[model samples]
Target: MTSSGFEALLEAVRGPASVNVLVITGAGISLASGIPTFRGTDPGAVWSNEVMEKGTHAFFQRAPHESWKMYLQRFELARAAKPNAAHRALVAWEAWQEAQGRGFAVVTQNVDSLHEDAGSRQLVKVHGSLRLARCSAQGCELGAPRGTVPMASVDFSAFHASPSPETVPRCPRCDSRLRPHVLWFDENYTEHDTYEIERTLILARQSRVIVFVGTSFSVGVTELVYRRGRKLDARMFSIDPSNASLDRGIEPVTARAEEALPELVRVLQS
Candidate 1:
């Protein structure tokens, strides 16, 4: 049986059509891979009032050690988790869309690199990535001023940030702290060159169909996609087991993305 979510996908994207489809995803898509959802009622969700307070740039400045200790753990968790069926499904869908000469892109809000691991093309990580880290100050080896390092090349085995800020990761030139490459609570998407906000909006504007998978729609990028897709009269669908309510012709498809997405692509293939 085809899911109502895929039903919408199939309806919006028939055979041999040049439809431009945009996929927006969030933490829920990574749940099957042993990651927890952010906004859900799950006991393991990463955010809270306290967490939100600590997730800001100011908090990192105030206490870099505590911030590094917490967020590096998140990076390690993300590194350990593997891509699940949902991620593979999107990769397949992208490949299929490419074969058909259609436009497709996936804008993921996850800090994890699951989409890249699953081989998805035209992928955008709007919230930054855990696979990367950068120096907080000017004139470093990574970037000219804010050099970045792939986590693989970095050891930091003795990773300690407790007794002294000097003990934490530091820039070679400026001796400033190095931070995780994730978007912070108080930072705008445009602050860092890593976030491809303009590219995301352009995709949203060009999309004839926009499908949001497992997101809570509480972020700025989500709102931008919603508004842009609406302006283009895009066929919108949200797939989540919670069946979260949506407005402006966006249909809610109550299902888990891991289960729903493969089925969605399977039907589209058939």
Candidate 2:
């Protein structure tokens, strides 16, 4: 389809009539805001296997302090970063859709919490969020509430060279070590019983329009969502500079999210 044709399609979805829409976003959406993809070529930082290992459940169990240090660095980066045009566009689009009585939800793989910061009310962070922390001891009551810690309060520099459990943040309710409230490498989403995964699947089946942004479908959850959406006959589109081929029906808009999403919002508004 031509560019104008695609815009026309988006315009149709943006009509006053209610429509179910699912938006899936990835790390690529935050690239303009200086967040690194960390996967594939052109990674912002060279994360050795050792560093990657630190993001696993087993690693966190074995070395809570070390794991916290690595995650704190990432949290600091995300905390310092600001939302870019794509994030803001989504916020506006969600509001506009809500105004029209449409069902709009965002299912994002990013843990940065940028979507939340951008004022997206109907959002699901599939990979959990870096802004929150929970007790490592599952039995602790603090795990139920999901503690929030300001990155500024933690001394990231202290744990740079060595693991310091004493300096590591702890749960307020129970003094147990606090772990980043993220889905670790070894953890299964289905087993965790989180609402994000279940809700994404439900939305994928019900959505009339599904938009994939800044993701290459390298991860299983994203790939599953795309395939399920296709099986359910949801109209699919992608916005990415890589031009990654996700499936048969996906209409590709070959550009970065920052460049493409704002224009998409504008076209929809028009």
| C-alpha TM-scores of all predictions | 0.92, 0.85
For each candidate, the alpha-carbon lDDT, in order, equals 0.82, 0.75
Regions of candidate 1 where Cα sits further than 4 Å from its true position: 2-5, 138-147, 161-163
- Using TM-score as the measure, which candidate wins? 1
Which candidate ranks first by lDDT, i.e. highest? 1
